[model samples]
Target: MLTLLHTADWHLGAQLQGWPREAEHRKALRALVALAAERRVDAVIVAGDIFDSLNPSAEAQKLLYDTLKELRAALPAATIVLLAGNHDPAGRIEAPRALFDLVNVAGVGTIARKDGEIDAGVHLLPLRGAGGAIEAHLLAAPYPRAADLPILDGASEGSPVVRSVRALYAELIAAARARIGAAPLVVTGHLHVAGGLESEGAERRILVGGEHAVPSDVFPEDIAYVALGHLHRPQSVGRECVRYSGSLFPLSKTEIDYNHGVTIVAIEGAATTIEHVPLPRPTPCLRIPPRGGLARENVEAALAALGLGPATPADDKPFVHLTVAADGPIVGLDAEIDAIAEKFPIRLASLTVERPPRRETEAPAPAALRLSERQPVELFREAFALTHKSEPTSEHMTLFHAAAAEE
Candidate 1:
């Protein structure tokens, strides 16, 4: 049996933007490497989105490099293959392929239209490793442009751009299948195949008739297994032979519900069995709402009710949304709010204060008086006059006295 570990969407450079996720990501990576070692898979396939951005920070690069190195040391016998996802810049990712290749790490980012066959006791279709293949024909389909294909029948005429894209992908897939003639053929692609699950924060809507939605029938019928990337959700599309491994870590809050991990596949003869490996130490987040007004007392009470306090910091300074209703007129609410903020590592992403309705017994004050009531102009004038008492002049004193009187 040929055992393969399938994982994707590492998003190594991902940051929670002031939120703490570094530790969780590190934990997830360790779990993945451990899974690979424990399973002793013959090979490992990473679908795509290995890095969150093309130009990741130095810290991110260091983390990825260290993790990959550890994985290599742990699984010296297994072949590790990494495909390029849309989030990664092809050119930049390709630069490191050669260096990794020196250590039995096969990087597919640099190879454009390459095919390879492997012999792991089981006769594989592609013979040549990496870029060049020694099979009847091995086709490697990268992300294809949807605007280069022929138009569909119902597609509006004169929409050559749209039609060509559809036609191009069809031709690409058709051309790929034409070359495979049994012999346990396998194709690896990074495009979104039809009938795959999409995670939150994925590219908005795959093109209506674009390359993202290639029909499952496009793959060769004899193809042993199709390794797919791009989509972050693990799923079997059309046939059991085709599958996505999903992402290795949750990239956003939307993915928190998803079980971040890798898929283990055992390929014996033509049959394949897949098992999902769970990630370790998933990040936990809580969203708390204020029960009453945002007055200092109420805010403290709400915090206590939610079981949150300055003494007990959250596992991660939880993302908090604070809503308060103030009972009476308050002063320096900003400073009081800041004091509350200092208590926990929690960041107030949003703070809302709702004022109670005016009482019928309360008479409406004049606009001037109301403005003065909130911000006393007299206090500012007095402070200014005291500060410049040394330079007092008739004109200055007159201006200061007038300002004080108006207040």
Candidate 2:
């Protein structure tokens, strides 16, 4: 039996609303390592997006290495594969190749090629069990720039990029199948699959702009499993064999609905079985009054309905997003909410005021603003008035206008 742990989109060192997530991430990584140890898996695959930013903080880098070290220590015989996602700086991710090799951890960021050809030797890996027996073949397909998969002039069926991507994978899979010779096949990648669900707010929209999503048929049906990344919500493509493991934790408020976790895959011969293990939630992420905001009185009444009696420990406080309607008087609004919030054992992560329309025919809010056509000072004045509930003084206007003029 060949059991594997599939997880991705760690986004290590990610910050939400300018709040550092190192502590949460540290706990989560350690938890994953412990989980792997408990499961006694033969392989672990991290699809991609290891760091939140291309230039991650030193602390984030250390956490990743430490997590890998701990996982390896706990599961000495397992093969751990870490690939790069769109957010990763491929070169930086693969920089410690020699060191990783020494520790029995494999890392692939940029696609490896030899003399203008996809180098199967580097991309295709044979998974070995504790008895030194080959269990499966893995194709590590990292996030590819246009340069990685060059298009060829030939009989084509899909868009150039899609054709290119499909061609690349087909070649690698074919190579892997030939090399491994009748073993369970696992393909790992970081891309937006056609039917995958996305986490709305901050999860990177991998298919933004002109780029299109690849159809589910991109991978062969015979493959045992297709592990994916890029999307923050866990979901399968068109079939059960292809799947995304999702991010380790909710990265944005919109992602609260995500049943965050990892997948434990058990493969025997060519058959594959997957179990999604949901993570524990010590603190909750909630958007009060789901549809939208409510009137001040209504909001208070809703809070009362929650019936939270007293404040809890700081670490146990839930992240809250409060939205209130404010067409009428907003006097003592924050104070009133604060009193109610104090009773709820939740941190007010955000407070949004929904204002009623000024007039039935009020000019539609422009979809976007063009600062080049207007003076910067004017924009500042408008924003200041709305935020501070008063017009800017002459001194403020002069200082701001002068600064804008310099630009």
Candidate 3:
């Protein structure tokens, strides 16, 4: 049996509303190291989005390097593969290939070509078991870029980009099959697949140009398993063998309820079994009123009911999103809420005010404004007219001027 761990979307060095998430990342990496050691897997595949930014901080790079060293030490015989996602700098991820090879680490940031044809050697790696014999073949594919895809002779049926993406994978898979004969082929991708659930505001749209999603049929039936990334939620797309292990932790308000974890894949002969091993959430994400918005007058009570007190350690404090009902514009509301939050140990990430729906007696909605006629002041005026049914007061214009100046 060939046992492997599949994980992705680390997004290291990410911050939530100005709060650094290094502490949470550290905890997740530690747990991952422990899990790999405990499972004694033959390989570990990190699909993509290793870092939140293309140019990661020195501290973020240090965390990644340290974790790689730990994983290598714990699983000396296992192969560790890393692929670059849309969020990662393709060249930067593979820049340290020389050093990575010393510890049995393989990474693919971009596709390579030789003599105008895809280079198979650079993308294929043989998985060796304890006996030092090849078990399965792993095709380390990364996020496809426009430059990496083949130029078709004529316009294809669906979106050109989608067709190119499918072509790219098909070519790579064919190359792998030709080279390895019929050995169980495992593949890695960092694009959004059709039918995969996405966390809004967390994952970026990667399928660029014409279509935003690539059909899961891109992978052939002969493949043993397909490890994917670029989505924050753990899910199987089209088939049971194709899966996304999901992010190590919640990265945004929309991702708070995700079962953040890694995946375990065991392939024996012709049978394959998959399992999800969830990681612990270090800090809690709390909504002030849980279900709905609370009235402005009761907002303080709702916050207090969370059992929060004075500020705790920055890393330990829970992140809170507060929503309060507004009968009309409340005077000094932000200042009042900030004051109330000062008495709690949580991090107030966002504040939203819910207004009652417009009555039927109000004027009908305004016609759509042309994009060419969009001046900052004119757009603001249109928005204010729609909401208040009146022109902006001089005072409102002054505030708008101040805000616009900052922008």
Root-mean-square deviation per candidate? 10.8, 5.7, 4.2
Weakest lDDT window of 10 consecutive positions for candidate 1:
116-125
lDDT of 3 by residue, 1-407 (tens): 88899999999889989989999899989999999899999999999999999998999989988999999999999999999998888887899999888888988999988887778988999987666778898999998877888777786578888888888998999888889998988999999999999898777787767476999999988889999999999999999999999999888888888899999999876778999999988788877677668887897788777775565677898999888877554568899999988887888888888777789997777678787978899889877866555678899999999999999
TM-scores of the models, in the given order?
Answer: 0.64, 0.81, 0.89
Deviation in Å, model 1, residue 102 alpha carbon: 2.2
lDDT (CA) per prediction = 0.60, 0.81, 0.88
- Candidate 2, residue 48: CA error in Å? 0.5
**Where is model 2 more than 4 Å wrong at Cα?**
154-158, 207-209, 297-315, 327-346, 353-407
Residue pairs with backbone overlap in model 3: none
Query: Which candidate do you rate higher for TM-score, 1 or 3?
Result: 3
Q: Rank the models by lDDT, top first.
A: 3, 2, 1
Error in Å for residue 204 of model 2: 2.9
Clashes per model (N, Cα, C within 3 A): 18, 0, 0
- The better-scoring model by lDDT among 1 and 3 is 3
Better of 2 and 3 by TM-score: 3
